[model samples]
Target chain A: MDENPGLSEQYRTASPWPFFIALSIPLAEAGILFNLFAVAVGGLLLFFGCCAGMLQEAGYVDRPWRSLVVGAVIVLAFGGLLLYADTQVANEAVQLAERGYAVLVAGIILFVGGLLGEVFVDDGEFAV
Target chain B: MQLNGQLALTILMGLFLVGVFAWLTRVENWSGYTPLSSGGSAVSGESGYVSEEKPAGIVRWLTTVDHKDIGLMYGAYGVFAFVVGGLMVILMRTELATPETVLVQPGFYNSLLTSHGITMLFLFGTPIIAAFSNYFIPLIIGADDMAFPRINAIAFWLLPPAALLIWAGFFPIPNLIPAQTAWTMYTPLSAGVGQGNQMNAGVDLMMLGLHLSGVSATMGAINFIATIFTERGEEVTWANLDIFSWTILTQSGLILFAFPLLGSALLMLIADRNLGTTFFAVGEGGGAMLWQHLFWFFGHPEVYILVLPPMGLVSYILPRFAGRRLFGFKFVVYSTLAIGVLSFGVWAHHMFSTGMDPRLRASFMAVSMAIAIPSAVKTFNWITTMWNGNIRLTAPMLYCIGFVSNFIIGGVTGVFLASIPVDLVLHDTYYVVGHFHYIVMGAITFAGMAGIYYWFPLVTGRMYQRSLAKWHFWLWMVGTNITFLAMILLGYGGMPRRYATYLPQFASLHQIATLGAYMLLLGGIIWVWNMVQSYFEGPVVEDGDPWDLEASGLRTVEWDWFDRKLQTKIADGGEEEPVTDGGVVEDESADELDTDE
Candidate 1:
């Protein structure tokens, strides 16, 4: 078995423009406005992982179509879960749902940010 | 997918039978072996690693610092303490089973309940986790030994004598019976003179023992933190730290802050008990509330210290079996830190019904509820980690899943208890008991089992009978849910905790719980049998990565460096391998390697 080269090298030269335009904008809107935080966050995470995978496959940063598609699906899921929660529960359960939504949004933002950061920033410079 | 009691029971019994059969078959077989020289590749390898030479005398067992040996010692001591504590609980349950003081005198029963609660929490729960951490953390982190190996030995040595002193009141010593005050040993009640005029010497001794245990724990915590931070091999970077190592770091941080408070509080109590001081005395000079504040401040975070390491272990093992990287590794790590910080603020929630001011109670309630957010994050991360992954139903993974289920119940109930209005009604009731034990025993114990099963091969160099491990999990799951869930119902019926006797209406539930407790005991016995028998006879694992899979793109240093240590130890005649691929590669045997590059 040959030594498995790590993903860091592939991500080093990728462009951040597609990530910022396609995923970050919609995630930020969903997170701040509709409060479908969990979906937003989960989507963002998926997007980051996807982007990393893409970067590894194609040694470049231009994959707007894939990022946009993944980001939209994430937003929809958050919105759907929010609607379901509002219809299904009351009182503390409702509050729990709301909090879940907020966290989801935060998670998405972090994911997108992490991926974008990985692309734009020098890997060796980032301490951990 | 819908599980019912009958099916669950049958599955459990089947697992038990399989486990027994596996154990029987492995009673005389062995395979994997590593040369002694290779053992030093992990960690710094400065200390002597486990040699093929087995020690022949009793002194060898006592003085040994071998990770495996220490692990067994911890396991044995934890089991002993658990049995002692369990028996006390059984007596309390039997008495409560009738809603009357049928089992023993009221005072003696109080002693039993108090001793049982404290002993199990401090002696059993904490030490059992320590047993695993002590045994496996070094190995998994790719270290040859703990940073402070002698201190490791000292830590284990301190436990038995401390435990003996705490429980010494139970034995017929001259004028000493076990302390009647509850495990928390609340001031005034704890300070009160005994009925037999025997002086409060037992309480004093208990405090002293607790102090000793705290010191020992502090030393161990320092060792864990230092070892993980400083001793990781060059290839093992911050991101590449193993889940268990992460857990040990967090747990050690909790201990660093929490145990010291406990030590200081114990010191104050000791002074009050003997020096005629009024540190916790009531009325004009002494402040009873002061003790409550000090104790709970440490007490609450202590819960996390107990639960977090196991949580870390589960996070590590569950993903492996689920065939996925932990969902949101950074998030889980953040949540752990959040829990630790928030744990400090929520201690006052425990004192809500103790006549704290309304404003204070409300603030505590808010803080307590806030802490739930992090806990919720952790739960969500766990589910997501397992979602759509190629989940393996190994014994360790089962236990990890069980931990999630149990912790969910525990965390939800905690939210209810965090409310001031709800707590006023439930304070000192069986509801509180149910809530905590669910978290402590349910979450922590389940996590411990997950870790034990996950790391059994690494620690013992032998594979535990899978059938038996599965059996142990199922029986324990049923027994734990039944026992603790029944307590929740009992609490709803307005049954108060710490009462030797209860109203007749609570009898049926108490009886059921006691029966469940016995099942728990039986499950535990099966586990001990499996572990012990496997130690001598289980199949030896030769593969470097026994789980047969590794997560790609994982960042922790443990995976990068430690895994290679095992490989090199087996493949290259114990010679130090070159540090390759941008990670720590300390090559003590550089002269031996014939490098063509």
Candidate 2:
């Protein structure tokens, strides 16, 4: 723990993606737009997680207002667009259902990308 | 336990393992107990490095974050799994002793076969490699430890529960489902719910275990990838990072791609059984072949994943014994990278009999044959490295020789299997069995043993009994040839594999193979006993470089670490502390020893 203490903490703190992704799986099995619901939740969580990490890396003593606002709005808009399809046009449900898988996969990639934010080496180079 | 009970059992199992791990490393002291330190030769009255605080009894091991300690644990555990897996094979050989089900029921035999393959490949192969890699990579790459040490710990900690879960049905519970899916766990058969009252809760558990192993391997791979790429002490680079790390780098990349896919497949299989979706349910949108396609995609590269490290170890070890730098060093590295890319393209070769497209089959056949070229290059380079050289016939060197010899047969037979014409006839025969085992048992295990012997002194700081190691190596060689060669012959005689009973024509071959199995088992036991007993009480290596590294031109980083420790112990003028051997005498500084010399 003594060797670069902060690195150990970040490594130890569990990632949110696994927990959310696991939750989304059973929900997806419930059928229909429930799968899309899972995808939306996972993406929103990951977006926020990445924001938190990026904010920390950028040396923010307070909340990263500009970035956090930009991140939250972008995430909420994307998720809201999908959720709105659940109640609106009948074709919207069909379209979102088909694209749910694509969203889920994108979420996974985003989470992997988020990992890069906090895991850079001491020389400020990316670890991977 | 039933599938329904697993959700809770999983939680409890996790807690138990974590608790045990914590309990193991939390002891008070490790002073008298030198936790498996391998160093250079010790000179009389010279200072030796002694750890002051000793963590008490077993806890030091359980809680250890030290790479060397972890490596020793991995090596010991791998050997234990190897012995257990081997015993299962011996029982199966006995069952086939007389071309009849003489020893066990068909189902039990199936269970044994399945358990043996899983244990050998996942439990034995990777962990043993992990043993060597963990111990050496940090020292070799000039890093203090793995990039993510805690993740390394987590990766290893996943194994015990994984092992328990795989063989869960056979112990503590009676008549619960036994996972008989073999190593492949191909669909339709592995669906688990199709057979009434024949549901293998073990399949789900096995898949869960497989998933855990994938996570473990992936974590290790990520750590290796990071360590090699970033932690190289300014002097090391892609060109000069050493052959073993380069191979590990390539192997880690493969694992990253291969293992995650395996994990996804295993998870889908779990969903197919528990969830309503039929990802592999035949007659539904999903079918059996999907499983095979996905599996072999990961499976073929997996053969490389298991063997690549040993291949690297061979490249690293062979040169020192022969008193030369490895021949075609750059070519070997290029060939290794070539094979890593080419392995992904050869997966379809395993499916030649699956009625795949004729064009596809032919292409796969070509690529399968193509993958052999790099291996051939490796072989020629090894032999040339050994040719006209001052070869020291040490135990490690002898195993390297055996590795090359067995891998030739292994590789050639693979080419034979790669031909669509021959593969059609020999798809599930004992020839395939013999060929893969030659690579696995003969090449990889042989090289693994070579690495173990060559580095044993470096790790334990004590020399094994040379006479016993000689007996063990010869016995292993003789046993391996006698057993696997008999298998090839049986295949040529049209004997199929995974059969509990065979025609009377196979009686002699089975008996011969059985005898060979007995020999292998005896030899393996001797090796294990030699390691255990010798580690604690064997003669300490007085001069660290037993292989005479100064003359050999073998400049490995571990030798550097050995030099540093020796120098530090001398400069400190540390008094001799009771090491693992329980023998101590008054010690003088390295300066005094140098003056005497």
Candidate 3:
């Protein structure tokens, strides 16, 4: 296991990406109502995947890795859905549809990422 | 805000008067000194009580510093508070028993529920444990007295007024308002708006009183830390310190950090309430989230403070009855420290739904999950201690077993709440109530009972009636489980806590819980009767290792010192010749050997 300093620094480095995604997507989707929800969902999925990766790297958990994989997949899926939703909104027949698709995609990715990250981490050495 | 300014000034004046009076008395040497005594009678010779003896009246209790006297005062006061809090629960249960309100107005019922939660946690649970620790830690550590006896007296004195302030809302004070804010005192709700806003003088008083309680607790923590660090006998080394003392040391350390934060938080709230500060005022540059941050910072550790000593007591006594050394003493000690540190980081899990940054939420979830590791380690050590040993199902052991079972359920449910999504659903619901009570009521209270039973003979020199003790233990175990389990189910079904009346769907569960509460009350009454009767009428038992069949023959310093002291007193004609089962003479000779060494 890494010493406290190393582990803490590593944890710090790994933590910021999730916040970045959460913050950046809203700005990126500004004035583009069709795919806004999808962009938000994709950002959320990326955040969960980062958490899983950090937990694993810190040696704080042992788990199935399914959550991490799922989180990654969700990020990708939500990005695609957001793109599709943006097109739908531009078509103007279903402006709200884009945001709904984004939200659904984001939720799935983050959920899967969290689960996989927890499952794959090696937490035994730090067991109390 | 106008009313709060006046109340705050009044409290400040009262505190200043107390400080001045104490200082003046000390300067003039007009202070009456009361000596520590076994009971009401004064101890003769060098250890004569230091407290001033006055007319055997109300003032005697107010100024007494004798640890035993203070302990009894705490015990009686805690029981009274517990009964009051329990009655509130009973009222809440009755209101929820049907869809309609019965005994009180909705506002009044909310007050009852709020007071009940705060009173149970702060007044009843913590004080009862403090009572035992105050009385026994010195005795068990082989110290003649606490390191700071006068401060100890002051700590006990602080409780009554604080309690009165919290409950004072029940009475009609011409200008005072009972605080309608929940016990957590969430911001904006607690910070009154300028004129035309609803306000209560009672709320301000409660906040001031809470600040006093925090001060008193911090003082007690300092005393405990000093006593363990400096007051241990010359012969006692760190490793040789009894388990109970070790627990006190760690718990005290936690308090040293935890209580001051509470003090500061209360002060900030006071400023906001009275000085027009914007620390917690929503918008206008203050955030409601700040209160959650500050409150939980101290609040989570507060739970550990409540549970740690009881855990220590259980660790101390369980091995004696098991007829073996503790399974992993160092492991238990380390895990305690680990838990104390880990507790600070997990407080944010309580704020999962409060809309903190999601990354912050995830970090909190990870830390919360990590706490389970140390807690699990402690649990494993306990199980290994009891595994395959000569287990005696004594009353104390029964309570210990109950503690383990109840705490496990508490711990498991706590895990469920750690998950962010899960907490989003359960936050502020009855489930949260069930989770805490299981730990506070089940684990801490169970540990308190265990300590009382284990030490009763030593304290009073009399054996409690065994049959009656058994009945009390069984009833309490059943009543505790029944009462809390129903609440857990109700909480899962989305029943909101602190509500006067619930929907009809929750009626059956509420009725069940109320019935269980009656059983709990019955159990408590029986326990009081048992203790009282045993003190006066039970058969006398000579103090020794009363639970005699230990594998290593009671190696702790408390046993060694107590036996040595009892023997010397007999030889010096300070005590009678204790009747030994095997007719062994007192070990006064051991004292001579020690002197020669």
Q: Pick the candidate with the highest DockQ.
A: 2
What are the Cα lDDT values of the candidates? 0.68, 0.71, 0.68
True contacts kept of 2: 0.00
Q: After superposing the true interface residues, what Cα RMSD does each candidate give? A: 26.2, 17.3, 28.2
Give the lDDT ranking, best first.
2, 3, 1
DockQ of each: 0.01, 0.04, 0.01
lDDT of 1 at B1: 40
lDDT of 2 at A119: 47
Instruction: Give the i-RMS of model 2 in Å.
Output: 17.3
Better of 2 and 3 by lDDT: 2
TM-score of each: 0.69, 0.77, 0.71
* RMSD (Cα, Å) of model 2: 10.3
Give the lDDT of residue B82 in candidate 2.
89
Residues B1-597 of candidate 3 have per-residue lDDT tens digits of: 956764565465346435544533442121122222322122222111222122133434544545666677778888889889887877776666677887778887777777887898788877787788787776666555676655576576667767877887777777665676777888777777645232466776677667667767887889888878876666677887776777778778888898899888887886666545568887874578888898999999888888888888888888887777887899888888888889889989989998889999999999999998888887887889899988899999999989989999999999999999999999989899889889988898899899888878766656788888898888888888887898899999999877877888888888888878778877887888899998866765545566674345754644544455455454556333443111234443334334321
Off by over 4 Å in 2: A1-128, B1-57, B196-198, B570-597
Q: Which candidate, 1 or 3, has the higher TM-score?
A: 3
